[model samples]
Target: MYSAFKIGKKFLHYYFTAANGKGHGVHSPFVFDLITKVLNDTTNHPAYTEVEEQRRLLLQNETVLTVEDFGAGSTKGLTKQRVVKQIAATSLKPKKYAQLLFRLVNYFQPKQILELGTSLGITTAYLAKANTNAVVTTMEGSAAIAAVAQEQFDALQLKNVNADTGNFDETLPELISKPESAFDFVFIDGNHRKEPTLRYFEQLLAKAINDTVFVFDDIHWSAEMEEAWEELKQHPQVTLTIDLFFIGLVFLRKEQKEREHFVIRF
Candidate 1:
């Protein structure tokens, strides 16, 4: 993960170099539609308040759990025990981006969704609530954390989600190999290291279809993550790539004539 100063510098560079959030000069019809309809959409769904209220309760909770670090450890360093509120504060995605994910899934309406992380299930709630018809499979490493996330899902009545708790290396491959595991939408947030991130992408490629969309979180979190993002952009199967500073979206649309990459301000 990047330091505060480094992250600030990168944001400045991204803000200046990236395209405007509005669909102004974007020429690609698909990307233009995304910018206009999904990325920039401001409609506040009822789920937003409901999910955020759960987050508030989590922030005030003082329970501590034993955590297992399977990926690159946190920037602040990892420990055997961590507070629920601290994990909620640092690990969970903010409401802005989480809601944007909800809108993206709500608009695209992917039937099968896979999430690589389930930290407290806040983002999972957003994804599951977005499309009641879509089935969401979320993976988490720690049993204790996964329990908390499952409780959150139960409280929200998000029946569409299935939380799988284990090391991603052990759980992801098994899930992907299943006969019914054809994911049209995937969120890669479990591991932050370069090799693991790229490995997950490659594994997911076998399950992808022409219209599958994969979103990677914390793309610019570190130099290695940026390297991984660049390598993913060059992948032959990926038709289009969108960089939104904090997240990177990859599209595998067979209708595209040529591969293109866009950095859009969000």
Candidate 2:
């Protein structure tokens, strides 16, 4: 993980260089629509408050659990024991980006959704709520964390989610081989290292359709992650790429004969 000062510097550079959130001079009709309809949508969604309320409650909880570090460890340093508040603080996606994900699902209405990480299920709830008809399969590495996420799902009454537990390496291949593995939308947030990140992307590629969209979290987290992001962009199947600083979105739309990449401010 990069130091706070380094992350701050990168953010400053990104902020100044990326295109504004507004459609402005962006010429691609599809991207323009995304900027106007999804990225810039201003409606105050109810899920914002609902999921945020769960985040608020978790922030105050002092319950501790034994954890297993499977991926790139936490920024605060890894430990076997951790408090719920500490996990929530370190792991949960910020409400802003989580709500953006909600809006994306709400807009695209992907029938089959796959989320590689379900840290406390805050983001999972947002995804499941966006399209009630969609089936969300969310995976978590730790059993204790997965249990807490299930509790959150029950609290939200999100019946569409199917939580899977275990290391992604052991769990993902089986999930991908299933008959219904043709995922319409995938959110990759589990392991942050380059090899695991690329491995998951390549494995998931087998089930990807032209319309399938893949979102990678912490694209600029480190040098290796940035390398993975660049290699993904250069792949022949990736027709379009969107860089939102913290997260990167990949598109494999067949209609786009020419590839394009955009760094958009969010």
Candidate 3:
């Protein structure tokens, strides 16, 4: 409890400082261009409209469904009374994140994409649209939510998306054991708990390609999450890590010699 408070305070301080253009002051050329082109570049695109439309659809669904939460539930939403609208609103992947995911996926054009959480398929939709040739496998814990997401995917004609509904503890292991399991992009948005996050990272590390990019959401969510992100950044395989307050991105590039970690404003 106390640690969460401290993290929240520090996050607020960072937020104010970042907004003033004081952050990312003459960082790596690569990261500087990324910040200017991706983060600071607030140019709205047609895809953003698509994400907003999906958000509207999700928000309009007043239907309530039981949520099978595998991770810590931060909301007052009990496992019983989980409204679709509430979940849409309370979820971590806000509009900004959806936009970022869309832009990143489009830019990276990763052949294989893996998403840890498939909440209403908002992020999944963005990824699917970004790379039509890419095969997207999204895992969702709640059967009801997963069903709804699958329906949304079909309705949108997003043929690349495959929604898997099950307890990730078993599903992830089985997927990792598969013979052809190489992922160029991985989004770690599920199971926000510290130990589980680290465990998942270690387990999936084998599947990453040389140019793999991993994005972990809510690094400043709590002290434990921050610690987990920091430890992940220090991993031998991780050559670069970018801390954008809301998300921490990891890049495993063999060409980069020195380990680099940057905290840039987005």
Candidate 4:
């Protein structure tokens, strides 16, 4: 009962804290345009429908599994013993976030992509569909979820996506240390703690291209996450950031001298 109450409180806090329309009086032309286009995109695409169908299917399967959490679990009292269907139903990607990622992957056509979390691989599939030639490396801390996602990838024939199951903190360092370590697009959705998020941000900065795009999930999930978002936005290399409450999009465009930030309502 206390866990339920805490979740309710967190939801209310987030709902009330979010800035309404006009994105807190944002002034950047590019950000404003991005807000109007990506965040506020109302039309449903075919890809979104496919993803939604898959999500529904995952939710219907009442299979139970033991989950290995590499980061802090958002839910209270969550243990290794949990229902697979429950996780799929309660922890899949939001529609707004899915659309945002779809648009980003479609627009940028990034040759290489790195995703921190592959919870069921819904977001990974969405990103892979955008550019077939794009190599998408999605890391999952749980072998159980990774197994399910790998099956999904096989059924979808998404050959470009590589769903690797392991401890991200340990694997990321080894991967980044390699000579060919560079990613055009990155999504950070693993660790929700401020320190780990900041550490990952700093470590990934070394592999960033001048025009790399980094997307962080659950930026407003907690005060610490929000603080991490703020710190990341203020980084010297970051020139643009778009806050959609749930996700924070970062851009490192060297061509732009001034930094721009926007809060768009979806």
Candidate 5:
């Protein structure tokens, strides 16, 4: 992964060059609507309050667990033993971006959602609450952390979440072979390396439909991740893509007509 200084410099360049978040000067009607509606929507839905409260509880919990390294390891260090609070602070996505995910699920209402990573179920909770009807299948690498996440999900009564524990490289293929093979929305957040990321994308691609939405996390975290993002953008099946600095959203919608890519400010 890139150092803080390097990441900061990249963010500065993106902030200056990305299109305005207010949908200004963007020509694509679908993208313009996403910018004005889902990306910029400020409505304080009740689900935000619920998930945030769970985040606060996680931040305060100090229970320690031995975590297994499955992908690009944490910047906080590769220590095996870590407290719940520490993982919550470093691993969980910020409320802003997380709320944006909730909005996306709420707006699109994808029937089947696949989450590549489930840290402590904070983001999973958001995805589950966004649409109770939608089933959220979340995968976690660490058994200890997965237990904590499952406990939180049970406590919050998020019945739609189906937590699976294992390394994604081993489990992802087996998952796609099941009856619930096709996914409407897939959030790739587990591994950050180029090879694993690309492998996951290819495996998931078999089950993806034209309307399927794929979101990749930490696209700019490292050189390899950025390379993976660029390759994904250039793929023939990818019709549209939006770069939000922190996360990258991909659209395979056939109705888009022409392939377009936008670096939009968020």
Candidate 6:
């Protein structure tokens, strides 16, 4: 993960170099539509309020649980026990990015969605709520954290979600091997290291279609993660990629005439 100073510097560079957020000069019709429609959508859907309300509750909870680190450990030194409120504050995705994800899912309406991390299930709730008909399968490494996420899902009555608790290496393969596990939308957030992130992408490729969309969180978290993002952009199967500083979105659309990459301000 990047230090505060490094992250600030990168964000400033990204803000200046990235394309306009209003789709002003974008040439690709698909990307233009995304910027104009999905990325910029400001509709205050009821689901947003409901999920945020849950987040408010989580912020107040002070229960502590033993967290198992499977990916790049937090910049804050590793500790066995962490408070629920702290996890909700430090781990959960911010409202802006989480809402952007909701807009993407709401627009694309992918039938099968897979999420690698389920921290407090706030982001998972946003994804699941975006499309009530889609099947969402989210994996969590910590049993304690998974239990909390499960409670959130149950409280929200998000019936389409399946919170699978276990190591992603063991659980992911089993889920992908199933005959009905072809995912059209995937969010990789659990692992932050380069090798594991790349490995997960490779494994998930087998289940992806031409229209499949994959979103990677914390793309610029570290030098290795940036390297992983770059390598993924150059992949033969990836037709397009969009860098939004915090997250990177990959598309495998066969209709693209040429592979392209875009850095768009968000």
Q: Which stretches of model 5 miss by more than 4 angstroms?
A: 74-79
lDDT (10s digit) by residue, model 4, range 1-266: 12557656755665676555554465666666666665666767777777777787888877888887777654432447768688887777876677679888887789989999898888998999878899999998888888888877886778899777788778889888988879999999888888889898899999999878999988877778878889999999899887766788899998877887756555
- Tens digit per residue, CA lDDT, model 5, 1-266: 99999999999999999999899999998888888889989999998888898899999999989888687855432549989999999999999999989999988899999999999999899889999999999999888899999988988899899889987877888999897578988899998999988889888889999878899999999999999999999988899999999899998888887899999999
The residue pairs in collision within model 6 are none
* Cα deviation of 93, candidate 4, in Å: 1.2
Top model by lDDT, which number?
6
| Candidate 3 RMSD computed on C-alpha atoms after optimal superposition onto the true structure | 2.9
lDDT of 3: 0.81
Sequence-dependent TM-score of model 5: 0.97
Q: Which ten residues in a row have the lowest lDDT in candidate 5?
A: 70-79
Q: Write the number of the candidate with greater TM-score, choosing between 1 and 5.
A: 1
| Candidate 3, 1-266: lDDT as tens digits | 23667777877777666533333465567666666666665777776687678788888889988776777544423366688888888883888877888878877899999999898888898889888899999998878889878877876779898778777888999888998988999998887878988998898888988888899988888768888988998898889998888888999888877898876666
Report lDDT (CA) for all predictions. Answer: 0.92, 0.91, 0.81, 0.80, 0.91, 0.93
Clashing pairs in 4: none
**Candidate 1 to native Cα RMSD, angstroms:** 1.8
Those runs of model 3 whose alpha carbons end farther than 4 Å from true positions after fitting are 1-8, 16-24, 73-79
Cα displacement (angstroms), candidate 1, residue 5, comes to 0.5
| Sort order, lDDT high to low | 6, 1, 2, 5, 3, 4
Q: Which candidate do you rate higher for lDDT, 1 or 5?
A: 1
lDDT per residue (tens digit) for residues 1-266 in model 2: 88889988999999999998897889999999999999999899888888898999999989999887688855422448889999999989988899889999999899999999998999999999999999999999888889999989998889999999988888999999898788889999998889999999999999988888899999999888999999999988899999998999999998997899999999
Among all windows of 10 consecutive residues in model 3, the one with the lowest summed lDDT is: 18-27
